[model samples]
Target: MNIPDPQTFTDPEKLRKLMANAVRLGYEDLAFNCKLRIAEIAGAAQDDVIEREFWTALIAAEEFKAAAAGKTSRLAKIRTKHRRVGAQRLLADMMMEEAVSDGFETLVAHGRAELTCEAIVLRHEDQFSVDAVNAARKKLMDHGVAMTDIAA
Candidate 1:
């Protein structure tokens, strides 16, 4: 299955097709069980770019926090970044609900799956580690999810 390019993920029809293909190809996260509901934003109207920006900023801040672990100054910067992005994300939550409603409808029509990363983590909690989570996040990001989309 070809991963859709994040930069070019702006067409609703194409996005739907991409999602369908992902499901067909067993693309679990973004393609099928999209917990982040990113598909909704992928095909949103041009006026909704703020949602994308907010997600991008939040993702970057999360990445910074992960990479800068014990760096107090870096963590401080991340805290500030998160505060700003969190406000934007909160403001956009309603629109986000509206945007994802269509996709949610589609998922429901196709039989929604309730599997989540937490489930997987619980199943293998004995060996779960920061490194493993990081690795999985990298794999998911490479498969089309943004860094922020992956939660530990």
Candidate 2:
């Protein structure tokens, strides 16, 4: 998929479509490229620009979730549940749910995933609270993963 210049792209719908297509195609570098674009867009003073970056960050988060989930039965389960609860809410809630229901290793993995999602959103939109990321970090620490390890 041809991703338009993030800075020059004026049509939000088209950008969204490109991002979605990139994700569906398993574009490995999409997240990195989107993150760079988002960082550049973050300095914009316009509300609309910030909102567009927010949606873009959400797409990156979804891509991360898909990559992390892989082709496991868990991924299939998540897909079914996502259709019912919606993607935005599901991404946030699923991590907590999985952390509670799964084993220690799974909990740590989910905590790291949650941290990544929170970090991505926070990086693009500072209006978001840091509490979620902090909680995720604390959960990981509780499970014996060092703070330095989490940071890395």
Candidate 3:
């Protein structure tokens, strides 16, 4: 049996294989949607290769958030703060990219609440307060999506 290398996060083929392995291990719902999202970004022009790494890290950050929200009390609290910090760092790094910045703006203008909320937070990290992000979210919800949807 060939074990996949663990340091291949930015490689599309390796990431796809890892995601497939996750589904085979009974994580289909979680892995499949993420895979599709990644695939969307991966299909972009070759010069847009940076999207793959950024999106992958973004997905990992989301997973960390989900894990932190687990029902098991002890497990939920264990290192959750650290995990959250890690997730935030990952997102902050992603926000530095031009494509992610543009995509985030588009998401806030047209994407679903879940994604918009994340984009808002990513776009206004240390410069904004939690309440500020909340206020932006509320504004977006009130305005409703009216922007052109950008294909991934």
Q: Pick the candidate with the highest TM-score.
A: 2
Question: lDDT tens digits, residues 1-152, model 3?
Answer: 55444343556556556766766777655454554454344434234233333344334334433433542122232135336654344444333333333333433432333343344343544544555455444444445643232112
Q: Lowest summed-lDDT stretch of 10 residues in model 1?
A: 113-122
Residue-level lDDT tens digits of model 1 in 1-152: 46655445554456556656665777745443232233334324235443443343333333223323423122244336446664233433322222322222222233321112322232343444555444434433433444443232
> 27-80, model 2: which lDDT tens digit per residue?
746534543344334324235543343334343344344445652123345446
**What TM value does model 1 have?**
0.25
> Model 2: how far is 29 from its true place, Å?
23
Candidate 1, residue 7: CA error in Å?
Answer: 4.7
- Full ranking by TM-score: 2, 3, 1
**lDDT of all the models against the reference?**
0.37, 0.44, 0.42
Rate residue 131 of model 1 by lDDT.
51
Mind sharing the TM-score for model 3? 0.27
Residue 11, model 1: Cα distance from true site in angstroms? 0.7
TM-score of each: 0.25, 0.32, 0.27
